[model samples]
Target: AIQIAASRDQLDPLLLSQAPGISFKYWKDATQLYLQQIDRLVAKGEDAKLAENKPYGGPVFRKMAVQLSLHDLKGAVTTLVDARLFQEAYVLSRTRYMDSLAEQTLRLWAHDCFLNGHYNTSSVCYMALGDLSQAAAALGKSSDEESLSLAADIAKVLGQTTFAGHIEEKREFIKSKKELLEKLDKQVEDQDLKDLPSRSELVIKENNTEKSQLEEPEKDTENAKEVASTDEKNLMSDTQAEESGKGEDENKIEKLLVELPEKMEGLLKDGIQNGMHKGDGDTMQNGEATDPQNNNEILAKPLQNGSEPVQEKSATE
Candidate 1:
């Protein structure tokens, strides 16, 4: 009723003055008046204003009611957007408000000619609010590559690796484009597919270039194949030699293992026989040394008489 009366210019200031709390009388704005009533409701422990309540009614009524309670920031954002107060609308879109959803919307809207400044301002707001990812993204939209790089660096310092990486890539992409233009002396007039270095052609060039240089000794395809074949043959020969060396080492190890038992048994038999000879007190004792030839003859006589020791027999077996 008040709305209709006010719209028709039939509402009187004297009637509004009588209803101080119910009207926007002496209030800075309608939002302030609505918020005062909402505060009263909160003091009484009433609900329906907070975001979790999912307040009923359409966007218009809901927006007015939602801001009064300071919940569901998107309601205010939507309302401001509908009113075409894009600067204020974008200012409210942030991490504390709608998180990344608002950022995504602002990023898209920044492409507009009118709202482009708003996007840059929003970026400054985001940076002041310490959201480097959003700031870098906004700078990119404004084509400020250098500032974008700086924002990416700030994000890296703050340990936002994923956001920093994405921002850095955008900066690098712009940088590469600039470099390519400079290298071409700003002659971007080429339209032929063969002249342009497309991504697929680059991949093919890399794969094909790895094997042969542009200027090589062997130009003929058959000669190149033959050289490759020769190199392969050399590799095979080296491998075969290594295998043969390993086999020889195994055989030598086996031979040494077989001879070890025989050597031990022979030493044992010689010690026993020498002990028996010592017991006889025949020749070597005290300071006297036995003759090598006589010792050999004595040992040989026992073998010739078909009386070889068990140690010798086991060793042969």
Candidate 2:
């Protein structure tokens, strides 16, 4: 905190209590220091005589006044007005010089005091301070061309009618702003809602396509199972037919073997008789020679007699 000395005469009890809610710890410290200094100057011995000398009086008084002005920022306007009068008196008596920066600061504080809680004060301050646009902007009026035209037309109707007419007009302006914002919010909601259906539809379509794709494989698997079952049946039937044909062929072979022995017996009997007849008739030709007709008759005799041929006669032929 800054600490500067306040003059004893400038100290006022009511000023501290009447201060607004601004921070003024520096001023309180300065007041305490000034009181201590006064107490030191009035002390019993050597410092008392030194305090009466004019050597450092002017600078010290000026410093004390600056400290008083800093505190005055927290004071009421009435106290500030009294301080300004006091300052003017001191200047007139050539007791102290006013600092330009300090004077401007006091004026700014005075302006803040007057302007507190007043819109017109802000308007005037900004306007005089070469801030016309800011002054106009601070009024909270709409700058949009359409709103401005509407406000003007409203004002014109108010001029033609009663002064109170524009009160309702102002309410309408607020309501219109709210409605416009609501419409924009609803439009955004509608766009969001639109995107939802498309997203859901896409998801549904994809799910259906995937379901169809999965079902197709299942159907194909069923067809393949049926085909495999049919092929198995065909293979089993073919095997059964082959086994039956093998059994029939075996039976036919057994039947052929039984008939073959009987046929062979008839041929052997016919051959022996024919051989003897050939031997008697062909004796003149040669002992080993035989006629062709007699040879055939002898070969047939073995089968007719149903007996084995005689070994002696067979050897001679």
Number of the predicted model whose lDDT against the real structure is largest = 1
TM-scores, each model vs. reference: 0.25, 0.25
What number of clashing residue pairs does each candidate have, in the order they appear?
0, 16
- Residues 1-317 of candidate 2: C-alpha lDDT, one tens digit per residue: 12211343233332333232234664465557556655666574535443343332354434444445555332323343444443333233232243543444344533453445433444455555554444443332543444434434544443533422443455467778978999999999998877445788999999999999999999999999999999999999999999999999999988777666576655555555565676666775675654556555555544333344443334335
Model 2, TM vs. native: 0.25
> How much is 103 displaced in model 1, in angstroms?
14
TM-score of 1: 0.25
Give the range where candidate 2 is weakest over 10 consecutive residues by summed lDDT.
1-10
Give per-model CA RMSD. Answer: 26.1, 18.2
Residue-level error in angstroms, candidate 2, position 126: 62
**Clash count, candidate 1:** 0
Mark the regions of model 2 whose C-alpha exceeds 4 Å error after superposition.
Answer: 1-208, 273-277, 283-317
Q: Which stretches of candidate 1 lie over 4 Å from their true place?
A: 1-80, 88-119, 128-130, 137-143, 162-166, 182-317
